[model samples]
Target chain A: MSEPNTREITYLEAVREALTQEMRRDPSVFLLGEDIGVYGGAFGVTRGMLEEFGPERVRDTPISEAAIAGAATGAALMGMRPVMEIMFMDFITIAMNQLVNQAAKIRFMFGGKASIPMVIRTPAGSGTGAAAQHCQSLEAWFINVPGIKVVAPATPYDAKGLLIAAIRDNNPVLFMEHKLLYRTKGPVPEELYSIPLGQAVVRREGRDATVLAYSVMVPRALEAAEQLSREGIELEVIDLRSLKPLDQATIVASVSKTGRVLIVHEAPRTGGFGGELAAVIAESEAFDYLDAPIRRLAGRDIPIPYNRTLERAAVPQVEDIVAAARALAQEGR
Target chain B: MTEFVPHPILDPAVIPRGSQQLLRELPKERLAWMLQKMCEIRYFEEKAEELYVRGLVHGTMHLSIGQEASSVGSIAALRPDDLIIHHHRGHGHTIAKGADLKRMMAEFLGKECGYCRGRGGSMHIADIPGGNLGATGVVGSGIPTAVGIALALQMRRSPQVLLAFFGDGAVNLGEFHEALNMAAIWKLPVVFICENNQYGMSGPAKVMCAVQPLSVRAIAYNMPGQTVDGNDVLAVYQVTQAAVERARRGEGPAFIENYTYRWRGHSKSDRNVYRTQAEIDEWKQRCPIARFKQLLIEAHVLTPEEVETIDAQAKMAIERAAEEALVCPEPSPENLEAEVYAP
Candidate 1:
């Protein structure tokens, strides 16, 4: 029972539309980051925002990532909703003190007297051969932090809706956008809407196995599921829009029906969000339904290489996901 | 070997111009009030130190013993609505911004009635309704936050300004430079006050910073900078007043380096092995409270008996606050998980 006014738009367009609509709707919301104003962001997600909102609201900051995160936190404490861009997700290490220590801990440390209502939007995942320093999927790092909400939107619809929800939330949210999904088009409604955080969507329901993924992995999982259907293997693909406050009920239900799970992500296999996902499934009622070990098709332990062939080899592609799912399905008869 | 030559701009004795003019123009009540507030801070810290010695206070505490004038004078120049963010040594800043003594004491005592409900003890005391954004234990962590608040003020076109208080130790921090540059370029309404207390824990300012006057770094950000005699209450007040006015007028951020001293070790665990007793004694002679008291007496702002009464009253107030705080209950375990996020 949704509206029928849907149009095809790229993921980047959806993100830009969400920012424009939120900034227009609320006076308390503003954007700040390096090269965001005149440069329109490194990826041009903020292009034309400077002309629409002017330089005061659309601020261009120095190349200091710490200041970008810290300033957004301070502004949020003063009752303004700030959406800051970190340029690249890997550079978040420079601003870790502000994001992890200050922004994440302020509200709790202050006994809830302060609310850091802010959003940090950064491009994540490995693709485009940006190398190790520029390309990374750091959502797991933020998901482990107690006081912050982590969101990784896969499609144009989730990107737009989740970005709006992140801006409206009363807690600090880390919105991770994949680098390669910027231009991918999907059917998106042209109205301002918010997809609630901590919800999962059943992209492709199946009975054989469940493929759990987020961000760019969702599309790849769907692609793998489609190809596996022709091979008589039915895979259920669930897109986890939010990492923290995870939609465990959906994941558990899918795993209970399929009796197997194949977790996929672009971050390294060691200590990635897939580990948390596997742990959540293992610790839940779905553990008894598992026929095989919860396999994770994730990026290799090595840093993302710059060469196209090695970069492609680092993270799981659609064929890798299909192969992993096929092997998991065939395990134990 | 090069002789230990002091830079001309870092000279601690160089007073600002129009000090006498500032003192003459100020009302007697205002001068007395400044003096009384400084006394309150001194007495509060003395009580806190006594409590720490008695094992009544937990955690490490940083005392701004000799920098009271720098905190009180600069805060006195701002409107009550203006915001402030302080560093770890922020008890004086909190009291100067008019936080209740009982709550502040309770915070140190780790009682539930404290400002942070006993969560943020000495280092993170805050009074949001009173416009104190809160203090941070991380060095130079609060600088960018001040810029952010100033940016919010500018975007909203609010008439309020923000004052960011940090130590000389924070000058070398990357965020400090980044924040100043952002504030300068955006012309945000903020005043960065560096309480140059001569030492960053054990490291001297001269060793930490290569520049002569720390305020001169403001030139890199294209903002006005000044160094004032921090012990002189009138001089600090005047310099801070001009900066606050410039911010209010939308001229941009200004940096003020108040050259002061810390009469005690950096923290409770410090052994004072970094400097000599003679050096400590030299800085002690320039005690902000004593100098401000002498100024008030000379200006006929308060009689010697009135000064004595103010001192006695501050002592009594601190004593009462400490006594009351000792009886407050600890936070309940039933609500241990509360307040992690907004309701």
Candidate 2:
């Protein structure tokens, strides 16, 4: 609830600002993770925070994902809002029990006696050429869980706003930051503000087909829609900022208008979140309005290759989205 | 060591020299309360076992029947405001941390008035308001969470300590080492107590363990570690007392391995193929409740008559709780999705 900064900043800077502002606004909010202190995090998302907040608030911890996640869960139970950076989303595998079983289920298991007010921030996606070990989109794992919330912000504006919202949310939240989206600059208000979770923002409105996306895929969907607009084909692109408390109303309304759907994500297709989105449409009133079968454009079911060329082919690209959107848009015509 | 069997009785020489005199100097009322709580836990699980065998309770449960001293003594050392996190076999931890007996039984019976509103059964019952954060079905899950609570307390500069309870099985988990190492480095105010009942399911810790005592792993973290006769209530209390006080003083975490035994099989589904009935019978002869009763009588903290009266009261209390829990309304399916996330 403060004034926003008028200047433009990168998505990574926006995330740091949110952490800085939240820690400043509330004493209970703190940051902890490996290399977050002096090293400024593995990707520099928390660079200047250590100097400003000191070691106590900006804790540099051992590389223990389980402890990092479990510590956040415990601290949240004690009424402290802790933000833990997992360095890479792929490393979250080591901490899944704490993330899925303990942190996610604590509130419900305790009958609402406690709420785990914690955030797990990890840089995700396949563009970094960091290979299968570091580059992968696993947001679907957190979304599959019942108690935790998942936030995948697309722009600098959403990155800051959703991070603030996630910190204030009285539940475990997994915040996915695409490695490529970090440097993309956009207008962000410097003052304290929050974007409510589960609210979808329609980046582009169209009548031909609806493009559902999140995280890094949102921008690609927007660019794909931009490319097709010249051919009189307009694609509606909806960025699902929050995954668990899904904005089904927005998704349904978009699909109802367009009568076609194209779900895109960086994760492999076999059991990715696209399947859940497709099921949501098929099971809802949106199914009645469908003009064509829903199409899913996702990563192939294989380990991400370290080779730059194969990595690009392993996940969806702007070209991939353009082709997928073009096909879905012209299917019924 | 390959054959799983514990000494039928405890060695009196293993008791710490000044601990009994420390017991004399301690509050008599607290000792009496611990005795009563231990009895209540024993009877509570016995009743729960009876129900599960009768097809009344839902799902399988892990019983800490032979490990009551480890729960009661460690919890007894904490201040009322201090927090705790329990492992799956945690009825004793919940009860010792001052949960409502009737409500606990209601949870076991899957009633709406239960702790988790029947959403969580035996392995997940919690009493958060009363300082028990709850338990998870997974082994060693609570270790890091307990350290996290300690980190919170450290940030707030709170004197409150977190007493984390787990089993011998949990000591082998990756999270255990990670959590302990972090706790030591941060000097977080927490006490990690391992209820080493010797088996993780059918696999005996004696065969699986690389170290003699589970607490020895704490040395890797450069934290204090101790192994105590968990059957001796006073001994558990003594070791936990030092660790709790050390944590309150911000000296960092301590690990205490309570060498106890679980008289029952791991759970209802266990067929007892791993251990013999002779071993079970041996542990039964060294029941924590009976040992505590003898300790109290000799120390004058409680008389033989007083111990029996407490035992009777505890048994009656458990029975009354069971009766009330059995008739409580079943939880409605409506609003089942409400608690999945906080509003």
Candidate 3:
């Protein structure tokens, strides 16, 4: 598939197209979850999809996450690649038993005899006023699991490419899409092209402190990196598309050149992806070349509030990353 | 040397002798094969009890001690392409499906040679290549999984049936309700084998279960439900064989409850205080192996001398498996990150 015949679309359209193409390509591919078919998905991401894929492929299931996950696992075992939607990331807790105990362990338990090639596509993050129950960032939860792959794509291009890859991959993948990012637009090729899971893209190149981020924070980090460039302190922003594999090579390369690192993410400071990046940098050969101890700018542990003011305060703003980068640059190791 | 012998014991009230006659009518070789399979399970479980007492196996070990008949009978009916999800007490199901006993025993010991590289111990043994998708420790988790397998089978128009082996306790789990609803609505080819071992942990079937007969719950789902003698291997086999045939013919799922009892505690650490010792002895009197052995003797299929050879063979096979599993190397640390995702 090439970009010549393909047209550019919004992140939402890109995801829809990817799913539609995959469904058409494979008969065994089907969707299952609550309010997805008739309701066109909870966030309307699957709008008009039910008519296209029909009731069989774009299925509307009961409000049971365990049922959805367990069914997906079962289907995968029987040679069907299923794409299951979990409306809210928070609700994944209800189905953790199937995801962790069954989906993750099935293949290994069978000594590689079984493969659960399913994707759990869920909307996450706090920008929307969906509040406490709906807007928590739980990527860290899936990242902790061994058998499943955790992926959160920031751009429309990556969203389409990564999802296609996830469906084709012969393992369970937890695909987390930020709630606020669905409408965001980018140049996604009409032709199919899959982005590998564990690779990182250099969103912006600079020589000062390296800023490693993922998901919604990647765009924000790149924006901050541009603003900080005019202040004479250039920053390198690395977008970590896949969290579990953690694309250590790109982060290590960027940090080695700059000698100072500042990791930014929307997840809370305690035990977040930033901690994982920091640990990797500290343990690697890049540790000896650091000009300053790696600093992390992440969200506070407080619950995301409904109020605009409180919600903004709960997550990492562009100013937070810029400030963290400046402070790290000033304090040399 | 200790002489190996098969002792015939009986209580037809638990398992009727007529079912054994049906088994004999089936291919004689097939009947012999089924009996050998059940014997292997009995020997393995007995060894597990011994190892559990010695503290070699960590975590609670759920024994399929008395319910071997139902496990072997149901699995024997499935084809190579058909899928099965076993319950926590799943050793019999795994072994019946052709899981290598040495590797399986290693899994119980949490050694690297275990199927999951020691990640999942005794409660979650799996070998999906042989159509054994694996078992879950969580009650009723496999119900939806089996439903999903059937759904896929239906989508592919493949004549493959999915089987889920659960205990009577699973009927109480909410997932069971959701799974049954899905299976009924789609009319998927799934066989729900409920080994009604009379108790969930220490709670008796009569006290904990609100429903009189657990199989009756299937009727509400618009599926056929039946109750069979779980202690009688042949009886379980006959009913389940019919159910499997129905599923393969696309007649939809069937709920079959096999009434049976476990001869030991729920797990090794269970203090036998919840039930009286007399109750335990009563169920022990209806042991599946004893009843089946008596049928073989009465029918002249196996003589006292021939049965003695079978017992010796079973013990030797189990002992060999134990030795091989004991010496097998643990999974290398590098392999820990290997199977998480396909490369």
Residue clash pairs of candidate 1: none
| Model 1, position A263: C-alpha lDDT score | 96
RMSD of 1: 2.7
Q: TM-score of candidate 3 restricted to chain B?
A: 0.91
Runs of candidate 3 exceeding 4 Å displacement: A1-3, A326-333, B1-25, B51-60, B100-103, B106-121, B296-312, B323-335
For model 1 the local lDDT of residue A224 reads 95
Please give the lDDT score at residue B192 for candidate 2. Answer: 90
Between candidates 1 and 3, the one scoring higher on DockQ is 1
What lDDT does each candidate get? Answer: 0.90, 0.90, 0.84
Sort all candidates by TM-score, best to worst. Answer: 1, 2, 3
Native-referenced DockQ of model 1? 0.77
Expressed as tens digits, the lDDT of each residue in B110-149 for candidate 1 is 8899999899999999999999989999999999888888
lDDT by residue (B74-116, candidate 2, tens digit) is 8988899988888899999999999999999999888999999
Q: What's the CA RMSD for each of the models?
A: 2.7, 3.5, 6.4
What is candidate 3's CAPRI-style docking category based on DockQ?
acceptable
